[model samples]
Target: MPGYELINNSEKKAVNEIFDNKELFYNGKRVKKFEKEFARYIGSKYAVAVSSGTAAIKIALKCLGIKAGDEVITQSFTFIATLEAIVDVGATPIVINVDDSLNMDVKELEKHITKKTKAIIPVHMLGVAAEMSKINKIAKKFKIPVVDDNCEALGAKWGKDKLGIQSDICTWSFDNGKTITTGEGGMITTNNKDLSMLFREYRDHGHQNNPKFPRGRDTHRIYGFNFRTTEINAAIGIEQLKKLNFIVRENKKRYNIYKKELLKIKHLKLRRIPKANIPLCDCIIFSIDDLNKIKKILIELSKKNIITKNVPDAIEWHFAKYWDHIFKEQKISKQQLETKFLKSSYYLERSIAIPIFVKEELKQTTKKARELSQIIKSFV
Candidate 1:
């Protein structure tokens, strides 16, 4: 029943400056400036700008040398982009289940590790960090790298470490719905110089170094792709980064309001994340014993202009066709695939991400949530 708006005048002005200055290329000054600003915010030695979050993941995998026959362990309940990135790098995705927090189940990871396993991608689903300590220990034991998919978790922290600060390589998205928007952009953060170089080169068509010269210059170096983010996007990103703290504070405030209001409805359940974690999005997941009745109620709410959505499905559904090909190619038994792929440890059937943003006040959203709660209770 509430409303949401995109970036305000301050963000618009930054975008205008990029066009006014006529700097549109990735190698332009605006892009460099934003990269520095983002790296400082994320506390990483290097940040490579790319076109999108999916591109960031693909480049990170490439920089890490994840290739054909490599098994990359990841959760099966994440965005398809996460799995697709692994597959793009010619690596076979080793799907695992998620825990109660909708993060990679550490126990399931060890069972699936093979000699071909090269890395583990621990996604900070809904902004909550996976059990990174346990996952990192396992990765260290197996000599596998960790690439954190932090697209949905811009300012999330676990213990004392920031989400992207502790991994071998971390990726972030600046999509329209994320905590910050660069219109369409992404960033890859890492401390490894060699890996950073690889990502930079890959983003700029395999140029051995910076290519800011005239026509027909020596630009091509190693094998790469065109995944570069423009200065215009980076300029918008710089402005967004400036308001990061404000955005995070408002999101947390809204989450608390939702928690307070939803608690009054006894039959409704909310998804649980660890107390130590800070989420990127406020997801309310519930399970109704009578699915048809709940669907009827939802439809009625929709007629009243109230929106809702199902939480993400298990990864198998999102990547079913891919898994089929993988299973047949590897000649793995159907039973093995089921055990490895079909079982999702944490599956919530009814869930929705209520609106939250920096410009909105918590009191208003809380009141709305309480109103919705009352309607749901009437049905019970």
Candidate 2:
């Protein structure tokens, strides 16, 4: 879920747009406009709409010609969708450690590359940008393509440039929890014209226009899956895109409140923000040494009807060890990044995420934020 429910004029505008033009329910004008506007917003040559972020990644990988036995490198800490997309397309995920910024460590890229490494999928985790400059620099050296996973950090920037254009192809999500939601939808952005055409065809069951038939009559050019979303979602996306900057600014405002109050607390270690990147967050992440202490605090918070969630278990779905299903099917030649891995596990297990927006349950004010911080310090 999003940190809080958002009520805005843009949502009303979305409904109006959809209601005004409801005839073209599937693959219609709204979807087309949203794609164009989105492309322009991200400064990409093309944007292909898909059913979900997972579909966006899958299509990008497919267009890149990644197949079975191809190893794709990505962060060890990210949403499960990133890993599942690679596996769904018969590719292995070469999990790498996240640096101090809790993103894919660029320094470790060279050692992970081998003949089977087809692509690098660096995830922008929790609205934070992974070091794209160094990651792209290394990809350039090896002549490998990168599938930028900008699902969590859509409007977030890496230096002066937007996050989408740094890689060969990139994806953004519009599901419920993302920075901006389209109910259930995703977009694929790329500067490659030929690849964009393939993406267009791929999303619609490989249906390409045929001169052999008339308009609205097309034939399958290649085998493709139907991951097309509806016009209503696209319409919502169009409106949401307009307010992205405001939403990002509001989120940053709330994040700063948490930072100001939490900095005085002794036991918590906040995540490091990358130097050149502007990340938007709905929650503030902090790492602690004792999971048991956090559990006690979480329980106490729940008693007061304030929820503080435990960090995602890196050793669970996000970690490399928990992915036995993917690894079991892999070739024996796939080697480990390290024989012993605990640092990633340590951070994830002891980490905690405090929601910045708690809806009407907790008024979105600095005073309430300070209260939340005190409650945390009191528990520790």
Candidate 3:
């Protein structure tokens, strides 16, 4: 319940329109329109709509030329999707510690770069922003392309620009819980024409936008996959994008309320959200120790039908250190493994996300939040 969603006549009309139109099926009709709107929304030259955020990351990595033997540098504490995309591209993920900013430690980056370090993926974990300025400067010096894993940070900002614009390639999700939704979908944005062309060709099964081989006919220009969005999803996305600004504004109000109410419970410490960044604030999160105590509080809260997540899922998968699959497969050195324990647990294990969804029935959400806070206070 810690997510925000608002749907009305627009989504219904979108679905009906798609169902009525037998002429416009899925050959990039609605998908292309949504992509154009999304690209314009983020001020990017191009956008390639895909099946999910994971697909966007996969293609972004492939477009960056990361291969099986290459090493990709990314934040240690993030959703497993970041690591999944790295391994999907056959690239070894070199996870580094997150500093107080709750992002990849830029200081640790230079030491990890080598002949094998091909690219850097700065995952903007949670709604909070990652430190892209310093990371980008270091990346420019080394000439390694920075692919922003901006899935969790849609509609987020840093300074005058949006989070995705600073990097070489950026990805977004319109999943059920993201700031925007098309049921399930993703988009990749970039300023580079070559990369844009590659993304298009890759997404469309290497067709190369040729007249000779149309939809029914085929000529494999390059190896690719069917990571395309349907007309139904794109139609919903187009309508959803229209309401994004208002949605963000309303959700910010809800987030502020949560922050104020929860801060009164001082023992359950809340992290100071960064000033330079304007986060989507889709889900309210806080840090707490004593997992058992937190678990007990959650049980009490759930009795009232209130929901909260345990440290962004679990301690093992939430933090990269305990990723047994990557640790076994990625060829992480002994030194990197040794340094993992030395890094500070900045946020992941110590945090819990509370349900703060956007609601038309505002009184109910607020009342529930207050009740959840009181329940949590009792445990403390």
| Pairs with steric clashes in candidate 1 | 76-315, 127-280
List runs of model 1 lying over 4 Å from the truth.
1-6, 210-221, 286-297, 309-346, 361-363
User: Candidate 3 on 128-198: residue-level lDDT in tens?
Assistant: 77878888899999999999888878878888777799989999888876778888999999999989988
Misplaced by over 4 Å in model 2 are 1-4, 7-13, 16-24, 210-221, 290-296, 313-321, 331-341, 358-363
Best candidate (score: lDDT): 3
Q: How accurate is candidate 2 locally (lDDT)?
A: 0.78
Give the worst 10-residue stretch by lDDT in candidate 2.
332-341
- Flag the better candidate by lDDT, 1 or 2: 2
Which 10 consecutive positions of candidate 3 have the poorest summed lDDT? 341-350
The whole-model lDDT of each prediction reads 0.73, 0.78, 0.79
Tens digits of per-residue lDDT for model 1, 81-135: 8877888889888777775666787888888889999889988876677888888
TM-score of every candidate: 0.86, 0.88, 0.88
**Per-residue error at 68 for model 1, in Å?**
1.4
